[model samples]
Target chain A: MSTEIATGRDIALIDLLDRLLHGGVVLAGDITLAVADIDLVYVGLRALISSVATAEENGVPLP
Target chain B: MPEADDARLARLKALLAASAAEDAAALLAEARDAAREEARSILQDVWREALLEAAAAAVEPRPPPERRRVRQEEGTAVVEPQPPEPRSVPQEGTAAVGPRPTEPRSVPQEGTAWWAYCVVPAAEADRVPPNLDSVDPSGPVEIVTCGELAAVVSRVPLSEYGDERLREHLEDLAWVERVARAHEEVLEAAMSATTIVPLRLCTIYLSRDRVEALLEDQAPGLAAALAELRGRTEWGVKVFAPAAAVAASASTEVAGGSAYIERKRSERAAREEAHQRTNECAQDVHARLEREAVAACVNPPQRREAHGRDAQMLLNGSYLFDDERRSVLESIVEALAGEYEPLGFSIELTGPWPPYNFVLPSASALS
Candidate 1:
């Protein structure tokens, strides 16, 4: 049982983000945080990841 | 940097105001020269900061927090304790315990609220396991039960999770990493003990009563979801096409312009065909795995950038499997890997995670 739970440690940030943001049990409440902001962050993450990938491909050192 | 320099110059200017006229003139000239040098260094610093902020913004569109001196002085002082506040201290005996109910402190800290990590059946309240060491290190992860369901929750400053703060924090990779890991850690701990419906990251409620109200209102749906998820765990499988082998095969040399052009066209066609074949292979593998699991879902293939890998992802699927079927699922994954490895395809299996993909609150629960 411990091993099963421990496997979550191996999950990559992107994969974790995918499930954390897109799936899971969402309980809508009066909390003021915007879902739109999360979507923007997701978009930004995609852009950032692609930029990093392009940098890696070109052998350019990331800042 | 400019702020510090301005303060220093102001002090120097004041002292020079009382000095001899000629001496003050000489001193002021030297100070002016020093200020110019300082300005150049400050410009460079600003440029570097701009570059870093731009990079961070490209990843998550928000202004990065100002670079702090603590980061520069990191080697000198390894740990800096946060400012002492009444809210920082967890009430006695409430610190670092499993699912016991602790009195919620009504500290008048503004813009802070309860962030729920997960909800489990009330029957499993006592069995909620201890949390990971670094997660919510300063707060207690207590369970608040409403009728049949118990929610795992902790206090979070609303300033950090409110619209503006959360947006800024989400843009910062380090902050997101810490919070996301902590969120998962609590869920994993509760999951180790019993069936739990893990909530999405940053699920905040204004008060404990609100949290309990949510649990109460959604009790039936929550119970149903938990029942469906009982004795089951989720497994993730990602399939990738080997980049190195594909690149190697396409790099074969050819003679003359016309021959090179012909080879390039054929290579393009081959690559397209390989991509199509990989997709079909992925679907076939997913279908086989689905047969062996209780429930399954295929998420859209993740962007290559997210994984920081050169290979193209062919499949990103999650399967919910019964405890008894764990071995069968592992063997199927093993067989698929063996069958696919020779064709420049690879499969990575993860979890027995909390059934993140399977537990959705029924539509009626929301209303």
Candidate 2:
């Protein structure tokens, strides 16, 4: 039988993402950007949002 | 005839000379008075606006309609006439305008500057042993007029790195944690010296000129706000149940089964029922805790696919409370945990932290 052991350090990547992106004092402003930079953030974010959505649809919980 | 002509000419010349001299003096006096009034008005208008904006944001839901007109761009409020009206009901498949409507609305931007920060007085900063300056040698520490409030500012602009790549780094959780931890350290320094009104994270200014402009524009009310926040601290408490424990609790005998296979089948059904109940319990517990807080926010819970190794369900939260009530709040958590223990739930609470989630740009600053 294979049972997973829990460690204090073993925080899920999604948990870390939640705290980092959504938590803390958010001070938003007119953020300047270049085309390349915008493309990078856009692509990365789209992938993340879709991946998480798919996981939820499949009945798998995201960390 | 000759004597008469000479006398008239001399008299006319004398009159013209005196009038010109008097006119020059009067013009100078008028300019001086205007200059003085302009200086005084600058101080009153900007400071009052900052206070009103900060105070307004502190209120619940949307701030005043006038404030919504002011857009925050790079730490400055761009005040323009209202654009075309927003749709009363957003159309289907359209993205939300402004920041997420569900999240907190963007309050008019107003706060103390990056360079001119408030710190505990010299004695207080010293007494703290590890002042913000010591922890981050890159920042300079300046003494402030207010009690124990000292300002610490970085020598170089973070934007100077000119690395658009920096935002990508921000996406990294470890990198974000390092920055967040640094911010936490500064706040800790403030607590040691005096009650601190922490500026929001990633607050950047164009230059020292802007910093001074912000400070000059908003000194008195900002000082008053700092006074109000003195002696307060923030704390966080999260409660969750490990899946295994919850699963085990639910696995009980339904009907007597002579065969081992029959008993196993019953256990499987019981576990599924237990898991569903536990999920619901976590949601209810989260809602109750949020209501109890002076200011509360919930980060999305991580699901089992990502954190499958963990035993407990995840509920992320933060609370801002008076320092004196710290023990009281802890006791409340203890009581809640005890009450829910029979249901297989546990609570974990942490902090005496800086007021990270509660720093709204007050409305008073907008006026």
Candidate 3:
């Protein structure tokens, strides 16, 4: 808790993305979401997750 | 946030004024706007028609007049001493939804789609804090009720949120960051006052009708899930340590060939034991914390690119605890962290999140 490892600031962007993309109430079927339309988006986010990791490491500021 | 929101709020007010004027003229225009775009236009027409039918079979039939009064309390129309509706305790082991309704219609306007954020029980619907901003710039957050449940949704323009366009945007990290933050912002605000079952990112529909239909079809699961979720909070903890810390200690004294060979063998054995111990440490921490949680899980370690840390992640755990139990969970995490810190491990706690990991009973259980 004391070595600056416990962040008091907001959680990292990657952490939020991890939960938002990977977690939450997902139902099956096309009833509410055309579950197919977003499959590629999920895949796309997987790639972004890695890119975000790189950007943060390089100290890249998001526009 | 406030300065910008002032202007946005003004614009939102004007937009509502214009829509209110239009509502006097046409209300049945946007049927079905579901994934297939079945977003029907709303309220008295759809709410009464769908709610009464669905309520009859689902939980309890809420009187239409009472529900309408609840809607008024949502805005500046009129505030009055409200009657607490009978608490609708769900009946377990029953298919509590109404008859199969007509196929949801796909009638989204050329430019906009309904983006639903989360579900709250109908009883708590009126208490949703107001003036919340949505993912859509001009779209103000609002609740659309069906039967025993209601969805917190807003209109997102299709130009930006359309399936093809949304997929394109997901590749842009900045765009994802902006939307992801905003999406969480809305849910976070709403969840503060009430229990909410959050939908994943990008849950768009054609109309509130389709949103209602989702409420109808999923009522049983929704009620059951809400029952389990009420008064509970989700928490996450991650542990990281340098890879070298998990490696055997090295010395510079051995120089002979046979001595070097013996050193290598012993070092390999020590390294194997260290790795094993490190894993046990992670498991032991999660296990101890889980004891204080209503639900708990260990997710895959995040990649270096994901966390940007020099230390390799050993644990990424999420736990759901009853509100009263959160302090007990924290004490457990504190005790574990203090015990593990001297071993070169650092534990980070993150949450009060919207039960993201605990949302699906079946999903979390299987994992």
Candidate 4:
């Protein structure tokens, strides 16, 4: 019951990360620092990412 | 130098000296008058002109126009009118203007890494915005070109972005927010000027050479991605079922026990019918959007815990379209909104962003 509407230009942190971390042209390289270890980091960020996502969904304005 | 040229040089030196002295005094006075916006603007103009004159005087003794043009094209000259400079200035003036003149290009001492923002075709290398602030404010964004691709990159301290330190930073929500915003800011600047393949967040390399090597190694794949993204942009569309209205419609009552039982059964049936209708509506919307989009992808519906909304997400889709189709897609969204709003469902449209979803190889292909 809490889903909120969002426009394309909103530039919300959740949306940015959704496109930035979840999508984009990724090239695997030895020297390039990959987000490959993201799983390890995501475990720590799950709470925050989820909260922000929830905030966006609930129409709560993020600071 | 000729006698007349020597005399002109002397005159310029005298002017510069006078302006330098006057500038110091005017700067002090300008500080006192800072409260007055009009006075501050006039002082800024004077300072700009003085700086320009000094720069012109310094370059006066250089070769004539033809030679200077050649040098500029060769990338040795610093004073040429660069096209990307103007666009690099933050339009909102919230952030500091582009990089400072003294910003370091690279740090080779060691324990430093290069964070690459995006890549553009080598032909558009000159279009890369200069003086852009990167995730590391201390480092300025620069381009590393290889064959046909140029990587937009900035140098960062490895101690901060190295595997361990970066992993730690990512855990800090505030830190992640700042770095992610900076990354997008640089991409937005580059996107405005050229077709770019935005690298994923936190993409870093050991050095500039490594970035160039990456460009060389990934040339084929990168080229294909760029070709697919040419003249196209990504848009997002989401549909939500209005929980309150749907809940209200599902609520009903009857007085008698037999009537109540019958009413409950019919209510369950009606609710099931509405759910099916909602699913059908979502599918219809996606089908219509796909027809107008050059490429389309449907993302999994977000969970309620993640979105913090009680409403169920019926659709989450991204579309890629050409520039001219922007209005067409917009109108379609408008029509969809109008048609669905009355059915206890709402549609939201977003984009014209870089083709983030379309350029990447599909997950199945990668697997």
What would the TM-score be for candidate 3 when compared with the true structure?
Answer: 0.65
Each candidate's interface RMSD: 11.7, 11.7, 10.8, 13.1
Chain B TM-score of candidate 1 stands at 0.65
Worst 10 residues of 2 chain B by lDDT: B78-87
Writing each residue's lDDT as its tens digit, candidate 4 over B1-367 gives 7999999999999999999989989987766654353344345445533442332223223333211111111211111112111222222331211121122233233477788888898899888778877899658898889999898988888777765566567667778778877887787777777777887677677667767876776777777667666776778887876674235332333353456546555654665566566666677788798878777766655545445456766676778777667888889998988899888787877655655666542222333
lDDT of 1 by residue, B132-183 (tens): 4333444578889989889888877755655445657767766777788888
Q: Write the per-residue lDDT of candidate 3 for residues B1-367, one digit (tens) a residue.
A: 6899999999999999999979855644432212122122122224433432232222212343211111111111111211122212222332121111234333332576778888898989878878877887758898999888999988888667664566567666677778778888877776777778887777677666767777876777777667777887778898775366443243444364456556655655655455555667776877687666776655556665457667667777777778877679788888888888887788888877877766542222222
Q: What number of backbone clashes does candidate 2 have, counting pairs of residues 3 or more apart or in separate chains?
A: 39
TM-score of every model?
0.68, 0.48, 0.65, 0.65
Misplaced by over 4 Å in model 3 are A1-9, A28-63, B1-109, B246-256, B361-367
Alpha-carbon DockQ of candidate 2: 0.07
In candidate 1, stretches whose alpha carbon ends up further than 4 angstroms from where it belongs are A32-35, A47-63, B1-111, B131-138, B244-257, B361-367
Between prediction 1 and prediction 3, the one with superior DockQ is 1
Which candidate number maximizes TM-score? 1
TM-score of chain A of each: 0.67, 0.47, 0.37, 0.38
lDDT of each: 0.65, 0.44, 0.62, 0.62
Q: List-wise, what DockQ does each model earn?
A: 0.21, 0.07, 0.16, 0.13
lDDT of 4 by residue, A7-50 (tens): 22357565666677666655542222233444434444567767
Minimum summed lDDT over a 10-residue window in model 1 chain A is located at: A28-37
